[model samples]
Target: MSIEKIVDQALQDGYLTPSMEAEVGRICNTASELSIEEYMALDRLMGALLTGEVVVLPRKQFINVMEELVLSEAISQAVEIDKDGDQSLDVGDIAAYALNRLPPLYATTEEGAQYQRSRAKEELQSLIASQVKEAIARNLDRAAQNQTVLGQISDTPLLEQMNILLKAYAADYEPDDESEPSTPN
Candidate 1:
């Protein structure tokens, strides 16, 4: 949302959501110059915030316990793999992949989060390890595929590279000898 709209919403709702605040920051950062209206809106928001008219919501009011578990597992596995001189694994990617496969355990209180963490450790530890291992395997496979594609492209003639790309991407592409290739209309 635009800064003006976000500011107006905050004024009306008496609260500024974290997402709205982030959007405003993103706009201001990307724009070369803010318009007079945007500046005025920002000024209004600042005044509202300072005067306690609008409260900014906390960015993270809850925790996902599963995310923490997956991240810890991924980090340990990544460290071991790194020590072996294997391809460097992206811990974030591994965690994300494992998290997507695992059931989320969300908690708003520390006691609840602790309970969830213990429950996951007791029941889902093996599953978490397996998923992280799968993610690492997939990452390695993708890296190998990318390496093969890059090897094909490097130090090759431009036309050969184009042909390689076309063959890799297009199922029924055929180069015509008599005329230049025609694009499908």
Candidate 2:
């Protein structure tokens, strides 16, 4: 099945959350075929789904931060307006002043949506690149741990032991610096 179909199915089955579905869509829409980074991103995303390791930010905290920023801007603008003269605004005057300075709140235009999708895809790829590095590091750590345990079990040459330990993760291993950055294709 296509990635979009898979994501939709996962979402409907409660295996993936809406935010994750959005990220998957971002990945799929950015390219006709997955790049190495995209593949790793999808891998991490699915792993999160299967392992229930999804990290969701609290909605209330996001709302509070947004509200704080908006209010701060409004107050700043109100102060500027009041400073024009030695005038003190009553509650209603301040409210009206703040409201007038606020930008229109409405649905995004198609151009805006396109820009947002592009930005999201870039951010997702960047996040996935870091995740891939971390995954590689973890695998290396596990391999080292296994090597230490197995070394105590036998007198295997260290080179042979290291080879065996790393073989699992070496098949597709490429240093991040050696790979081209993921771009839409």
Candidate 3:
């Protein structure tokens, strides 16, 4: 959504949600330059925040119990794998990959989080382990593929690179006459 829309929503709701804040941050970070209206909208949001008109929700108020479970599983598996000194896996990547495949267990209170943890352990431990293993395998495969691809790219000639790119992106691409330098009239 546009910054204006987000700001308007916040004003109307009297609270800025974490997702909304993240969206605003993402938009600002990705944009090369903000329009005047965008800046004005941000200014308005800031004013609202300062004046207690729009309360910014605290990020610490919520937790995803699944993330913790995934991290724990990933770390234990990673430690054993790393013992060989052959493969170095990214625990975070494995955790994230597993998390994507697993169901989210979000909680707003300590009691809720504890309950979710117990439920996950009882019903999802095996699934979580299997997903983590799959994530690790995929990560390893991708790493090997990337290394091979990078090696091939470094060895390829510049003309060959251009040809490969053209074939992939524009199989029928042709140079336009207008693109060429023209003689002075």
The total of clashing pairs for model 1 equals 0
lDDT value for model 1: 0.91
Give the Cα error of residue 47 in candidate 2, in Å. Answer: 1.3
Best to worst by lDDT, what's the order?
A: 1, 3, 2
lDDT tens readout by residue for model 2, 41-113 = 5676577666766543333211122223334444554466467755343433433333344332322455654
Instruction: Give the count of colliding residue pairs in each prediction.
Output: 0, 0, 0
Worst 10 residues of 3 by lDDT: 162-171
For residue 48, model 2's alpha carbon misses the true position, in angstroms, by: 2.3
On residues 1-185, what C-alpha lDDT tens digit does candidate 1 reach at each position? 78999999999999999899889989999999999999999999999999999999997779999999999999998889899976978888889888999999999999999999999999999999999999998888767776787677988899999878767657477768878866899
Give the poorly placed runs of model 1, Cα more than 4 Å off: 1-60, 162-185
- lDDT (CA) for every model shown? 0.91, 0.50, 0.90
Q: After superposition, how far is residue 25 of candidate 1 from its true place, in Å?
A: 10
Better of 1 and 3 by TM-score: 1
- The digit string of per-residue lDDT tens for model 3 on 69-170 reads 999999998888889768778888999899999999999999999999999999999999999999999988867765655556656889997666555456
Clashing pairs in 1: none
